[model samples]
Target chain A: MLLFLSFLAIIMIASSHNAESKVHEIAKLNNEVRELRTHFVDGKTELMRLKMESSIVKKMMQKGLKRPERPPRKIIVKN
Target chain B: MAVKEKNILNRLYFIAACMFVFAIAVLVKLVNIQFVEGDMYRQKGQERVFKTFDIPANRGNLYDSKGNLLATSVPKYDIRFDALAVNEKDFRAHIKPLCEALSKEFGKSVSYYDKIIRTARSNKNRYLLLRRNLGYSQYMRVKKFPLFEFGANRGGLIVEQRTVREHPIGKIAERTVGYERRDEQGYYTRVGLEGAYGPFLRGKEGKRKKQKIAKNQWKPIGDANEVEPQDGFDVVSTIDVNIQDIAHHELLAQLEKFEAEHGTVVVMETKTGEIKAISNLGRTKTGRYYEKLNYAVGESHEPGSTFKLMTIVAALEDKVIDSSHVVDTEDGKVKFYDRTVRDSKWGGYGKISMAKAFELSSNTAFAKIIDQNYKNNPRKFVDRLINMGLGETLGLAIKGEGKPKIPYPGDDDWYGTTLPWMAHGYGVAITPLQTLAFYNAIANDGEMVKPRFIKEVKTWDKTRERFDKEILNPTICSKETAKIAQEMMKNVVKRGTADNIRTDNFGIAGKTGTCWGNYGKDKEREYISSFAGYFPVDKPIYSCIVVIHRPNKKKGYYGSEVAAPVFKTIATKIYNDIPVIDEVSYAVVESNAVVNSYDKYYQNAQKYKTIMPNVKGMPAMDVVALLENMGLRVKLEGVGKVKNQSIKPGTKVKINQTVRLELS
Candidate 1:
């Protein structure tokens, strides 16, 4: 009985230590996720700013491309 | 000697008794300490080793209606160095390269870092700041730099990570995206959607019990957490990124050209009342413009000529005047109790129709018409506006919405000329958003819908709440009154004040408003230029308003010159993006060419099952598919129609036989 009780205590300690490591791993992973999300948002914001209509117009002016005078027309066929 | 020995024996017995007393006293003290003081000492030890740690929950992200990220919480790092931990040898060996790397990363001169680092080392400053508030990628790059690569113990690098709110679109919609921050006193300062939905965006914090282990690390004591944290729910707003971008740039460009003090633009969906874009820009001391405050939703001032729509609608609803009722402008000015109202046109439109009076935006004309109709009982006019929900607050989700002040008949500010002044949009004050909502109601055929910012609240994939189109009033006026008002606004763009802003492709119905502002007892008056309207006069989709405050008087102050152009730019952008569909009645024409080709192709395929057919005019691709499907290998040369085939027509085709087709 004494040996079994000692064995149970040892197992409990080992499992608790295992849980501690797992917790640390989860914390690290969460930090990584936050870092990745920050990068994604930063890149997306840059892309949106670059692709804005004003920016595009400014860029295309050097190429002598101006906005269209009339809107595009679509023909609808009724069958 | 005998006597001395006997005395010594007595001394020995006395010494033995003293020793026994000392031992017994020590035993009693040990027992007292074990039983009485043990618990107190054990608790003190536990206090040093055990701790309850708070685990902060991540703030939720904010997204646009199309799921584009607007705001999110990101970890920002602060890097510090411990000068004392570095030995002279390691410092000397790595300092030059480390300084070079830092200079390259932070865009500073290498000598500047070298001097600061040397001064810090000489002073033995343990916590020397290297960089503050670096993004995650920059922090990671800095962590791999020469001295920092060795980490805290070897290289003396100290890094502190903090979560900060980041806006993806940068300054485009900064004020609307907003932020939430807490001080040491636990008081929160919230702004915009971030502050309005703080409780939902800031989730519950969790707690964990931990114990101190080796190397000063705290290990969680149990497998289960004491309390689990709930991450904040994401808020989906109604802003369309494209429209917001256009509104921001156009407003910025106009404000800069006019050198105006500040301006705001709001675009709303007519049917749903969803705010697609709201931009407020104020000039800075350095001559740059930014979204300093939400002027569109928070600044209330006299709406000038835009308010005439409300007055005319009220008059028409009361059966006071028809669209063709004639009004005399008395040349250019008219006199009231103590004040005179003048039209911008030197010689007035003189005896024009009431609709033309609105189209010309004649100040004297509106003043004369409204005062003549409602002079007997002024409360009837004010009640007409109040009944239209113009006097009430919009109760927007965002904080700091300016309250509209429309003076009543018995109010202290009311006077003899107050009705005429209010009729011409001077005595009353309304925010740009309120005016937009009123115009939106007209575009919606008199059904007023409340302006909404947030569309939904979600946690990961689960939706917590959804906000729909909220009806503030089922109908503010009769359909007939709305139609008359809409027609008058359209006439303004066509042949009136806003003629310059009219487009050839589509129709825009709106009013131009230019009013004198800041006219105190002794102060000089400034002009506030504004325009409000909806597009595609026949079927309106969106309603927009642009208000520019305090434009340079020397350049121009009229609404048509300063504000209407921005509205036109935004409207034209939207118009250019959408394609116009032209529908025609379907007509079927019989063609002999198609029938002939179909008959020939069908007959040849049906007759040449086991033999190769002459495919002279047939396209190369169809010939290959035909020959290959018949279990014969097809080899093609050149392009276009098949000129010749090796196999003769009506010849038997064998399996694994190669058929060459020449094409041109």
Candidate 2:
């Protein structure tokens, strides 16, 4: 009876530890996913900005050297 | 006494027998507990609880030399459903809204989602994969929906993470970098630079066990066991990005301007042979072109009159002909083996110097030089050409570089007319890069270095194996011979055929080659107009070649007319961009021609001058004195310093003529 109780206790500890590790991993992955999404969005924004500027410049060139209006800077909040 | 002793002994024996039976029962009970029934008790005590999913490791990113992202991985989500866990009544009721949300997010119609959900509903034991690679934002929005808001497990919805590839500067250097694809063998592969350095880019794959919740559902057990991916090293190219942009634009413009089918322009560093800009493009019906082929090394065409530079060099190296050594043109047509090779303009160009013949791209002249020297042994000529790096394959970093086509005597393809035609850059085919390399060799003071595209192969650790410039040799001539050949080419631009490139600011020393090719159909003449040159003429820095093939008639498709101008435009831009190190001597070439115009202006000034005004602290007196010497009159008035003068110093007057003088 004493040995059986001890074996059950050990199994319970192992299962809890496994679950703990899995939860920790999920949390870390969640952070990575958040970071990647932000970066992807930023990249897209940059591409759009470049495209707009290039077309503006092209139009300006056609008009014989007029300056294009710069686009407003996006304000990003940091935690 | 005997009866009493017997009774006691029997009682002791029975007691001992009972003790042995008790020990045997205990032994059997211990065996059953420890060995036979142990597994059942252990199974009853443990519970197989929460399962895990193994998250796939994200792939590394590829960056360019300037820390610009070439390719990168972005996080994407996959939607899955655990059919077994989903309550049938509640699931069926919520299924329509869920499908509608999926259709909205995926940009698909409601019917498509219906079909997908219908099939997924068929297998209750399985976790159905709804979609793969949804954006994180899309997933977040979908998760906020009322039906999907109950969290993943309760609603039986699952999201798995994956990485997607992205190019920051799409289509720039696309062909050279290449793409990755899975082949028929089920193995993933990459091509070009990406493929060549794939191992470094791929990094190591991390392993982990995932808990299989359902047949298809898995939850990662631990920290997506991150063997934190080491990103691919940045490729620092020898190419100057600005120059590459300029070359691309100019090459495209020239190709279309000539209505040429396709063309390539490679601007390489003179000494290092580091290709700064290589623009290889093929034309399309849309007018805009794509980099469909690496024509700079892949396409080999007879380089036409440009090949004359080689023949001239060979002849000069052999001491068979000097720059002044005249070759007979006769009728400007050479009939060898019933094949008449005539100059484009026809009729004899008179008995001109060898330099003039080269300048005019005279076929007959080079034909005479080749026939006179290498005719007895054609292999000797071909061998000499090969020795000059004509037919050799340049072991460049990029694969599929063509083996340069050159004819040799006794080869099955060789004909009687081969030597003469080869002399004028025909009957033997070579790529634009090979021809450019040969010219670049001459420009590099006769030291031939193989053209290098990749400057370094960098590893993941940021350590680089630098590909230093390899000098093949001092080539088939002494520096003197190379100089003479270079100067002869310089004269071609200075006064010869390529004078169209001459600008007041820069001197262009180069050659023009216009040749007709069969293209696809036999004997349908299509011209390949090309100009190969280096500038500034005094000190060579850049050797550029512009080849415009099959230009429409409207574009005036001559090498000088089309290609030389492009060369000038690109050279001018390069000159403006690069620091001008050595100043080109812009002194008059012909000193004896005239001082007469300047003398006439001086005489007119003398005829206009008169003066001898008040000479005391008067501004006008200076002018008066100057006018006095120049035979002109001047009247001086008020002065702090030459404040006023009546007659200007330049006013016309006879010698010793008097004029009024005034002072303030």
Top lDDT model: 1
lDDT per residue as tens, model 1, B1-664:
6679889999999999999999999998888778788788888888889988898898899988878888988888999999888988889999999999999999999999999899999999999998899987788899999988999988989999888888878898899888888999999988888888888899999998889999998877763659988889999999988889899999999999999999999999898999999999999999899999999989999999999999998999999999999999988889997788999999887898899999999999899988998999999999999999999889998889999989999888789899999998998999999999999999888999999899999998789999999999988999999998999899899999999998888899999999888867789889999999999789998899999999999989999999999999999998787898899879998698667766777777777779878888887766776777778898889998889989998899898899888999
In model 2, which regions exceed 4 Å deviation?
A1-79, B1-67, B71-164, B184-190, B219-231, B285-288, B459-461, B474-476, B519-522, B580-664
DockQ (CA atoms), all models: 0.57, 0.04
In the range B83-124, model 2's lDDT, one tens digit per residue, is 656667767788788878878777899888777766776755
C-alpha TM-scores of all predictions: 0.84, 0.65
Rate residue B433 of model 2 by lDDT.
85
Model 1 pairs in collision: none
Among incorrect, acceptable, medium and high, the docking class of model 1 is medium
Q: Give the true-contact fraction for every prediction, in order.
A: 0.78, 0.01
Model 2's number of clashes is 16
